[model samples]
Target: MTTMARDPKGYYAVLGLDPEADAEAIRAAYRQRVKVVHPDRDPSTRAREEFRRLMEAYAVLKDVIRRAEYDGVAPAEAGGESDFTPMPVACGTCGSLTAQPRYVVFRTVRSYLIWAKLGRLDGIFCRDCADHAAARASIVSWLWGWWSLPGLILTPFALLANLFGGSKPRRENTRILLRQARAFLGRGDLVLARSLAEQAATFARGPDDRARVAALLRATDGAVSGHHRRLKSRWRPGGRVFLAQALPLLALPVTIAIFVLIAIRPWDQPVSTVAPIAVHPATVGEIRHVAVDGLKLRMAPLPGAPVLTLLDRFTTVEVNAATASPDWVGVRTPAGIEGYVETRALYAGSGSRFKTEWCSDNRGAPPTAGEILSRRVSGDHRLLVHNDGRRDGVVKLKTLAGSTVLSVYVPATFHIGVGGIPDGTYRIEYATGTRYSRGCALFIDEMQASVLPMTVTFHYQSPTATRSLTNIAEVWLSPQSGTVPRPLPLPPDRFAADD
Candidate 1:
């Protein structure tokens, strides 16, 4: 093979023309070059080789399908008049002579994080060869194509293209049927030939093709055919064709189901045989706070037992150990309602007190009042927040859109100046409670909170060259007078700190 046959763009160079040269120019150039390099005229070895290369270039340039392939472009239509020929060509796979060979390109992509590579298989193939090529490319791509970001995007298109028909010039159904009809006619199978020729005549377009089909029909006339065309049956398991098509599609779902079954192993779970805690003797009335928020007071000690009522934080209850279970204590609410609450849900002291000594460690060494917990931007304004409530407080300055810009901790009855606040409208959310839990980073056992009903605004102004003004606002969690709006109740979950 000449270098022109190996190089895609060298075909144009072999014809002594640029890539932009049209079909007419290519044909004219080939005609002019052929005369000088004609082997019969020169009768030399070099002349024969040059003439062969020249013919190769002319063959590709003259046909739309070949030209598009050489140019790395997808033709809008395939198998035009110049593309189809009645002469036989050797199939790339089987190497047998076939009248209706299709030029097809199957593609697959393997991608990495930063790069990707395209794998291509292109050849002129007969029907069985093309089917084998398409199936092989699609199966390989389905198995290993999606390895990177680009592969995720490119692999699917490649797989679909291969599975459907591949991206290349193809003989249409009419031409294929006619080719089969001719083969049957050569074998003297007149009945099948007549049926196929009749079908081809219906699909034939243009005067020449229609006339050719008419001639085939006339030759096969009067042949009685009993055979009828039928659609291929749907794929079934254990069949070679079915496995080739459906295996890739079903691989992911089957793998996921296997993993789920292995991970859960619901069938082989071991049963727990540990006995429950022994119940203690009776105790009279004892006051305790419902330490946990939303503690369910159930009718019985069991978790699946019906709930009598939902007890909120700081709710007082009289404990009755007389009716207590190993894990539960009987309690009577102030409303004279009785239910069994989990023992862990009740605290001995008032809910306003800390649960343990460790929980109270942060009380004296409270977080710096003006500490900026989170800051998006710095500005020339400041906020002085006062924690007038008996409980310590942490105030959060959040944008009206609910994004927190700053947070400051202020101990009970103390005030702090928080600086470096950006100039924007903000909602002042404040939480006040007894002792802080480091785990929760908030007052857990007893907590009450609310947000300012109206938003506060801070703006910076430089009125003159020598004079500069910065906005400063003073906010009090507990309003000394009716002028300030009373804080609206904030839900515990909303005021809860991030983990």
Candidate 2:
């Protein structure tokens, strides 16, 4: 293989896994897939494609010798493309070329804000390889969990159609709303849900249909949002006129309030105390110092080696070992930035060696739940965020308190939030490529709480009510706790298979 082919980026991306995927993670993912789409069981065309990707992922990852050899280079270049096509091997006896399909199937997640529903998503399945069975299974699971009683789902759609000058579709749309209302009632969002079921009751096309929906709502959430006597009396007198002018104004504020809430950041505790010395120095050298800030690590022996934390300008590091590259040295820096910097960049009066990984349990890749206190834009479109670094890493963006900073999403280059992000609701302003452009969309629940940094994938299509468009803050909150940490290409056991 060529030197460039060894990089694992493409291979990991293909598996929808992260470059740092561990061993056990790979096995479990493979096992889950094999049980459903194994060639031995499934025969659907989609199943075949899944079998190919699964086999190929294992084939590249399982070979220890191949993995080590491949790891030396970047894995990002590998793909299920034509260049890496798989050839069918013949059976020893028949010599028949058993056909193997190429490519794999996966789905994309999307999320957006509407009137008052929170953390809403509309998942759009990738029309690639996986079978319907797997897709449907996921939908059923979300129906009970991520979705906020069906009202969030149903109301958003109906209200949207009505808002956009399409009343005819309202009847059909109401059915979608009722089904979700029924679900919300099942889970207990009595107020908002009762209103949804009640609206659905009014929109039923026929008497039987209306009666059935009304009965279901009454039983599940205990009566509609409007009492029968009140509704009847309003129509007899002047209910239509009253609701016409008054309802919209009342609803307008509620709608705006919800949007404002999603934009606000929740609260969290703070990290109290000074930076603890996590490293010790060995040699005695007079290393000069540069600048210091809230940042933990500063100097490095080389480009990719361990970095020692520069507590102040007087700290020194004793060089215990050396490395092939200039980025890192044995004396070490915080988090391992050993390749590019020189020993002079660090204080060498003799304090302590730099800690190997300066990450705190709630820090470094971990996420908490705090409100987004503030946001700022860097000269070249960078996000400078100051979040509550102490407790619950969630920074609710709307409240504009405790944690705060600016963010800029430039289209050409990558724009990332600076520092740490606390999880909760947020009202983020996505950048329009132009200086005069207005912010396009708002996001909420936009982050999942975790201790690991995760990659997020989003699409422009109808994303299944998900967090795609919204929370780009802390990525990847799994279905449940103990779910394997993401970007994990392999299970935590053997690390990743060869490639």
Clashes of each: 0, 128
Tell me each candidate's TM-score.
0.38, 0.16
lDDT of 2 by residue, 1-499 (tens): 4433433444544455653466566677667767887777989889898878777767876543234333433344243232221122221122232121111212222223322232221211111111232233234333432234444445334333222222223344354445445545555656545655665666678776788687766675444435532111111212333334335545756987887776642221111123473222223232323222212342444345454443332223345455465433355333334323343244332221121111111122222222232344222222233332221222122222322233222222222254333333333322111211111111111212222333222223244655332334333212234656442221211110010
Q: Which stretches of candidate 2 lie over 4 Å from their true place?
A: 1-164, 167-171, 206-208, 220-499
- Alpha carbon deviation, residue 214, candidate 2 (Å): 2.5
Task: State in Å the error of residue 354, model 2.
Answer: 97
Cα shift from native, residue 160, model 2 (Å) = 15
Off by over 4 Å in 1: 1-58, 61-90, 97-107, 112-124, 148-150, 157-211, 225-242, 254-439, 442-499
Top model number, lDDT: 1
TM-score of 1: 0.38
The weakest ten consecutive residues by lDDT in model 1 span 230-239
Error of 2 at 299 (Å): 99
- Candidate 1 residue-wise lDDT, 377-449, digit = tens: 7876778888777888878887877777787778888888888888889988888886666544567546787
Superposed by TM-score, candidate 2 places the C-alpha of residue 14 at a distance from the truth, in angstroms, of 13
